[model samples]
Target chain A: MAEKHNIKNPAVKRILQEVKEMQSNPSDDYMSLPLEENIFEWQFAIRGPRDTEFEGGIYHGRIQLPSEYPFKPPSFMLLTPSGRFETQTKICLSISNHHPEHWQPSWSVRTALVALIAFMPTNPNGALGSLNYKKEDRCALATKSQEAPPKFGTPERQRLIDEIHEYMLSKSSPLPQLAPSQASEEQSKTEEAKAQVNLENPEALPVGAEIPDQAGDRIVEEQELPVNANPNPAGVEASMESSSSVSSNQLLQKSDARVQNLKPDTRVQKPDDRLFTLAAIGLAIAIVVLLLKKFIKSTEYGAVFMDES
Target chain B: MKFCKKYQEYMQGQEKKLPGVGFKKLKKILKKCRRNSSSQKPLHASLAAKTCPDHCPVCDGTFFPSLLNEMSDIVGCFNQRAQKLLELHLASGVRKYFLWIKGKLQGNHTALIQEGKDLVTYALINAIAIRKILKKYDKIHYSKQGQLFKSQIQSMHKEILQSPWLCELMAFHINLRETKVKSRKAHALFDGCSLTFKDGKPALTCELFDSIKVDIDLTCSICLDTVFDPVSLTCGHIFCYICACSAASVSIVNGLKSADPKMKCPLCREGAVYEGAVHLEELNILLSRSCQEYWEQRIQTERVERVKQIKEHWDSQCRAFVGV
Candidate 1:
């Protein structure tokens, strides 16, 4: 593969890197390979996103990378009639060349394929080369998608697609044994239930939204809620300080008192005492004083260093 | 002597302003804390404690706070200096124009040179320090906290390269390169860093010291090629303008300015980074001046790509409106 392409070209070098990475970290979700004749042209098979009508589907697509490669987003055309996107047409997606302004050079073919799978279940919103088929139609197409690889393009491209489909099949199990009628019935019930949950709490529905639109303030409010809920964050913080001071040995007695006040857990207290004893035996000098103080504090041994600095 | 003294002064001033103790004092305290933590780890390891082994209150509460505080202080000071340097450079044009009208036109080359040289030195030393500390933290913790903190630093606009003024500094050096002819001393002091296209990849190598050389790759993380017409997102990741626009979903008509405020930086995943994207015009100028042929080719191709995108976008809009 290295000898076949001109390694001197930066685009080729990057494409080769992606090819190498894809081979090494083979994913169960999707499989991709560049065309035999052109390194820029790739064929891929992606598992349908779960929990959607498209589930159990094996969608095949072609990726045509521009000469500049990573600098430019690739054009994606799905040959399979998944019902989400028009067959044999370049899909206008944020991750595709049709929306080149949304492409990041850092994103590789792997990332794009993952994004493509994720986009399968979204409301196309009249995006160019997008289709909004009925739920039943989509499910029917999905089941059909896995029956055979869509016959398109050259025989070489078709062969690549077939191999990808085979690989995807081996990675996944046969779709759950469900009568089509019963499966559709269950799906409709779940869909209605999902709508009820969304209507009850519109906030929870964003989790299922394709593009997460989390406002900056909402995140800050979410973060502040925990702090607000925990009334003794300062006390928890003070315990932390005292424990650190225990290691530093400057204000051990003071910190120890505060630590005891905050956390009276004898079990939690035991580990620190044990750790100090181990340190005293190993180092024998600086921590010996700390260990002795802790021992005295633990045993209430005449309050020797307790009154002293 | 003056440049070195100014550099030290700036560093000391920055160190003094850090929360809690001064930088040197914090450094000493952290050194002791590190030693104590190292000693504690083996003892902790020997014991069969079911508690979280990695948790160390002393290291986390005391050592990290001081180190991170000092790091932020250094970054904040560098940003201020960079801003000041830019202000001075920008004002020079107005000052020069006034002088020309008064028939006394002369450049303030000395101040620009001094500020530029000091800024570069300051950036090199402070950047090295930050990298070293992060590396040490990661080494000691056996975690990638240092790596994660870097992105946090960037989001805060405290990243060294994130400053828009660095672009101006690059322009200053480029101008110096052309005008100064072959003054090796000036080049040595001001041009401590040089952009090289070694192995057909762009890398900026900075000779911070005789023994210490830092090489920063200039490859667009999106494209794995030399950055062309670079723009810096607010999160401080540099990418080609077109690439960034594509990532943010902002069309050429609206520009990056109108990109969704929730749009996250592709590199750091920091939201709203696109809204404040800096064009890096000066760096682009410097790049174009140095690599004329590559610049020409890129500009030609980019023009064609941009026009094609505009046409396609309008066609889509027409189809949507006219129902064709």
Candidate 2:
């Protein structure tokens, strides 16, 4: 109720409504919010699309809305150190204010964000606020993007960005567990559902329309979505982070051994010596056992002769 | 809810083996979701066994219940909007395509570059509407199917923008609102450019402003940018002429013609390439009209590359034949 009162301006109210809508049905690709002081100025971040040069990258940017927003287009500038767009410069885009004829009242911030993510990989072609970086440079910047704080937005916005990035990384680590094996299971389940529905009506599963990912992954996602499920997402993230680090440490150890092999002095050179010594000791024990067995057999024959006399 | 029930009944009937016609297959089996489900579609209230032409009722069905139903009208409204835009695109596109094809075959240079810009307004509107509808569907139903629909609709959108026959449709381009060039050959700059840098490197240096914000979603995948001299391959993937030629190892002199009819597309290498690829007229018009200087430079570059490729091919063949 208090939140509704805070937004007295009609345009501000509309912007607030959009924020609420986005929160309820958050996109997997990006997230955005207006600032506390000014609803017109929004901060946004997007996950670069998978399989592209921008993959695994988190790009941060700002959108400045006019007083007559839907009537007028917004201007955008990327603040993050993305190799694609220049920081602190208003970029020209069809959705951006550079083209008023192209702007329609129907387009919202959501549309703008989708277009922004999609545009990141395209050649800049000498466009304003556009960057044409080499793939390797962009890739290197992408790795840096994981930790680079917001250089342009406020401190609060930067904190939100960090939290969201942490969430994304933690979410991705658990995703590989669901890939090929579960996809096949989903295919079979779909077929089974179809067959069953043909005979009778669909039960609708009592589960909402969610496309159930692999069984375990789906549960984890559900648990993560609710408000009080964890109460502290940061804690869950920390544990997942530590587990991932331990696995990586094991991999690093394997690489370390190979690296040691390059230095003649540091190398553990006698790897086969223990195995050869063990084999020799086992051979000697077998010979002693054979001799003992022969002696026992001769003693038994002599005792038999004394009994016969 | 009522629509869901009727759809279920219809689907069951179709899947059933009609006891009379066991092995004598006569009727066409309309599989569900053949047309991408997420693309905007109209509700027809068809009593044709309550089943849509395709099977998936949620995405394609016309008869879902409406009491306390928030999404039915929203989806219907989006479908209407999309249908209107698509109709405009088809009407303008078909006429221009035929004219361009005639112009190409008859050697009419004037007609080839002539102004026939099909507007991108409807396409943009359709995109926004589709995005909203997909979001609404997800919000109401909480389904993962919405995610799948998104990619399906996105691919469909790309196909629409890169259609070979359609020409440029300028949207929100402020500079081109009143500006008109007299000659067809003179490429009028319809947009403005901005320059900026990052991290002391030549970072984010190139940015252009045009009629409207050109959604990167509509851009071609191969060029990592706008579809220039856009060509629609047999495999449904679109690319610039120079890019496609290089990918197929065919020079612009010989064009996309292949003796082996089996040359594969670079993107979907499994699909065999078509000899005569379709050029997107409107995209070329957009490229030339808005970015005239860049377009002219590209033409010069292509011409030089074609000459080099042709000469190289002949030299290699001749040397091999001569046992050198």
Candidate 3:
């Protein structure tokens, strides 16, 4: 099979060299090999960087080498759903084909895979095919990334992807702290929901409810709810910690059935608040006009009296 | 005179065989020393009681230590000479880079060629010496200690062939072939010296004689190719920098420097060798100069890779500070 590529092409020679090297010094972090049929297309899997959301994740991707490879960088597309990158789309990276200007001939599939791992933790900064999924969601995807190799292309390609995923599973660390934190994560979500209810109808809630939240906290939670929720799971964690601290107190309170009914009440309050601000501004403008009119009328009367004198 | 010369030659042959004369006797002598030391009798006193054999003047204890001392001496001198030659070449290269000297003295290609040749000769001679001594040791002692010592020196990075400077010298010779093309006469010194591939392994083959070709292995054990931007780890293994960096830490953005101190070499498995990795700039220059198109492409690619690295580094730093 190897002798089939006995041609004198430099790219083929380089790929063969890399294949031999990759076999000799196999890395635990990644495994890559060109297809048996087409030496230009490679399937690879990378172990996510440790201590990161992607840790314990085995991400599978495809590499399409140009005929002038090493000179021209290879194009990369993730086959697995890593929250960091959209699946089956060409990802833009300094080490990938999207940035040919940055591709080094000395860099092989090995270095690129390593770079991919390093890039896992970095901000996408809105690069093409990048996704800013929440850390929790990313962690979830990371776990899911290990479950099975992505289904793509031919049976051979699928087999290759499966083989790489298997290699990565054996190499990557066990699924991270995500497993243990899952129960607590769910508990926190329910607590947040209960807190939202309390926020909606603070007047209806008993004084002994022990929500312990200030008006400022309520305003922040309301403002940060929908827009920043996915991007900033850390904010959710911070709120979780505070909620957990007062959890024992809230556990003794009545069931949250009555709190659910008051969900619409908070929605009603937002527009009322806006209207109140508008009315206050209107009153201030009316008072200023009245004062100016009185002063002008008095001044005109004084001028007439002076002329008569 | 003819008879005397024949007799002298006959004596020399007998003398060569004399070292192996008392292997059993030496073992017995060592056992006596050990027994004496164990029983509280002085070791020398016990040995002094027995007449020393003609073939083995010194006991095994003193002979092995002295043999080791001789071995170290050979290695130490070779190391010093290699370092001095490398320093000379590097200093000249540096001065040339800075344009310190005026014309007539500015280009020292001849001097470099001579130094490179000398370094290669020194390495070859010293390596031969080590091999001859080890063979002699095994012959005398009827043991594999010489072979063991050879491997021990290799692991210790004390083997003369393992020196990074020798690779630089080869590069200089290979590069000189290109630069000295106009001076056909000077090219004679570097004739038939070039990098070649044999069975997928890269080697520097220099043909000094029609029958005497010296092959210096240049294949990066990691990449299985003629090293591109070769870096010598403290373990004395030469690998392409990119290969070593990937080996050390696939996820580290800072290349080899950010590698864990305890990370081991892929070839020798020697730990903590990556930190002091020396990038052989002279060898890199030689490779690039000798191969124009390949070098140009590599240079462009490297420049872009560097730019991307710098960009990534700054982006990460900015992210840290700006909390974005």
lDDT of 3 by residue, A1-309 (tens): 221442234466467556544543456677787676777888888877766898778888899998866667899999888889999899999988888755555578888888998898999999999999999998999888877778999997777677666655654433212235879777766766664454334235221222222211211121132342222111111111111123211311111111111111111225786797568667867998999999999999999999999
| Per-residue C-alpha lDDT of model 1 across residues A70-142, encoded as one tens digit per residue | 7678999988898899988899999888876677667899989989988999999999999999999999998
Off by over 4 Å in 3: A1-309, B1-64, B67-81, B91-94, B97-112, B177-193, B199-201, B207-214, B221-225, B250-258, B321-324
Instruction: For residues B1-324, write the lDDT of model 1, one tens digit per residue.
Output: 433343344555542243212445545655775677557767565344423236666656776676667666666776677666665544543464454344334555554555565666666656655666666656655567678777777667776665655655655554454333333232233345566554245555656543566565666776554578888877767888877887777777668999999877777667888887877665665566555555665677578668877998899999999999
lDDT of 1 at B247: 72
For all candidates listed, what's the TM-score of chain B alone? 0.70, 0.42, 0.65
lDDT of 3 at B141: 43
- Tell me the tens digit of each residue's lDDT in model 2 across A111-200: 899888878888788988888888898888777776754665568556555555554443332222223687777876776565445323
Question: Which predicted model would earn the best TM-score?
Answer: 1
In candidate 2, the second chain superimposes onto the true chain B with a TM-score of: 0.42
Indicate the fraction of true inter-chain contacts that candidate 1 also forms: 0.15
| Residue B269 displacement (Å), model 3 | 1.4
Docking quality (DockQ) for each candidate: 0.06, 0.01, 0.02
What local lDDT does model 1 show for residue B311?
Answer: 93
